[model samples]
Target: MSTLIGKTALVTGASRGIGRAIAARLAAEGALVAVHYGSNKAAADETVAAIQAAGGRAFAVGADFGTEGDIDALLTGLDAGLGGTGLDILVNNAALAGGTDLENSTPDYFDRMFAVNVKAPFFLIQRLLPNMRDGGRVINVSSGVTRIALPETVYAMTKGAVETMSRNLANSYATGKRGITVNTVAPGPVDTGHPMFQIPEVVEGTAKATALDRMGEPEDIAAAVAFLASDDARWITGNTVDATGGMFLGPRF
Candidate 1:
C-alpha cells in the first residue's frame, strides 16, 4: 500500500460504485487521485471529498470521453496535477453496462458501449501516456462475464480489447526494469449499485454458484486493482487477475 506514496492516479468513471471504490482505495494508499466522471458531478465530488477527509489528496474532473475537448482537457489537468511527480497510475474503470442478447441487440447499443468501454480507454491512454512517469501502471477493468459468455457481446468484446491492450501496452512500455506493469482486473457480479439483478432468487443463485456464499463487493475489485498498481506486482504484466468469487467456474446457464 505504501508503494504508491507520492504518486498520482487518474481513474475514469469514478463517480460511484466500482470506479469510486477504486479511486478511494488508491488515495488511501497515498496516491493523489483524479476522480473522472462522465456526467455525475455529485457522485464524483463526493468521492473526492471522502478521499480528502481520509487525509488523502484528490481532485474531481469530468470528461465526456471521446470528445476532443474533454479528452484534451482531462490529459492536461492530469499532467498538471502531477506537479512534476509524473502520472504513476491510470485506472480505466469507466464502462457502460447494458443488457442485449445476440438475437435483439442494436448497432447503436454496440457503438455506444464500445465507444465508452473500448475506444475511450484506448485513446485516453494514448493521450495521457507521454505525461506518465516511467515505470508507471495502467489497469483496465474487464469482467468475469467474458469467461461466462454473457449476454452483452458488445460490452464483452470491448473488455476483451482492454485485456489485449494490457498485453500490448506492457510490451511497448516498461523499459529496462523500471518496474512498470499493466494488467486487467476482471470482477464477477460485484454489487455496482445497480440492483436490478439483486433479487433474492438471483442473489441466492449467484451465492450458491460461488465457493463464497455471496456476490462480490466493489472494494473486492478495488483491492485487486490496488495490488496491480503496487510495486508488489511489478512482474505481473500482461496478465488478467480474476477477482471473481468462483462464479465463472462453468457455463452461465
Candidate 2:
C-alpha cells in the first residue's frame, strides 16, 4: 500500500486523535509528512517519534490556526520542512469545538469557529495550491452534524462550507489528468478522548443514535482519509464519503 511512496503531506491538528492517526497512516504509506499541531508540542513530537520508529519519515510543526498570519506561518514551515519542494497531500483536520449553543452563542465564538474551521483552511489551500503537485490530494475532515442538524449550528455550518469547497475544488481541477482531488470525510459521534461520553445521557443518546450501538473511533476516520489520499481513490472526489458506521442511516427509532 505504498501508493503515496513519492508524496509529501501536511496534516494539520495532527497532535492527537484522528489527526494523529492520519499522519501516521500517510507516513506508513511512504509519504514524507509534516505533522502540524496547535499548542501541543509534546503530542506533536510523539507523533513524529512514532512514525520514525515505524521507519517512516515525519517532522513536527506548529501554528495557531485561528489567527492572522498563523496559516501563512504554517505553510512556510511546511515548505521549509520539505526543502521548498511541492506538496502532494493536505489534511485540514484541526478544529475547535465551540460549546456555544442557541442562546449562549457569542460574537467571539462565531468569529473563532469560522476563522479556524472555514476561513483559514480555505485560504491556506489557496496559498499552497501553486506548490501542490498535480494529482495531489486534499481531505477535509467534516462532521455528520451538518446532515443531522445536531444543534452545533456554528460549527456544523463551517464544515458545511468545507464540504462545498471540496466539491468546487475537485471540479476546478477536473481538467488535468493527474490534477488535485478534494473531498470531505464526515464522521459521527467519534470518541476523541472527550469526557462527554462519560455522561450517562450522552452515552445512551449516542449509542441509540448509531446502529452499530457504539461510537466511531478516530482511526476509523483516519483509515478513510488514507484511502482517499491513495491513487486507488483517484476517481473519488467532490463527494462527502460518510464514515459514520451507520450512524446516519436506518429508520428513526
Off by over 4 Å in 2: 173-178, 198-201
lDDT (tens digit, per residue) of candidate 1 on 1-253: 5668888899999999999999999999999999999888998999999999988999988888755586777776665666666788999999888577788878887778888888889888887777577778989999887787877777788888889888888877343255667789998887776775568888788777776778889999999999999888877888899888887476554
- How far residue 165's Cα lies from its native spot in candidate 1, in Å, is 1.3
Candidate 2: worst-modelled 10 consecutive residues by lDDT: 171-180
What digit string (tens of lDDT, one per residue) describes model 2 on residues 92-204?
99988745677888888898999999988898888888768888988898888778776678988888998998888888844245567898998888788888877878877
Task: Give each model's whole-structure lDDT.
Answer: 0.84, 0.87
TM-score of each: 0.92, 0.93
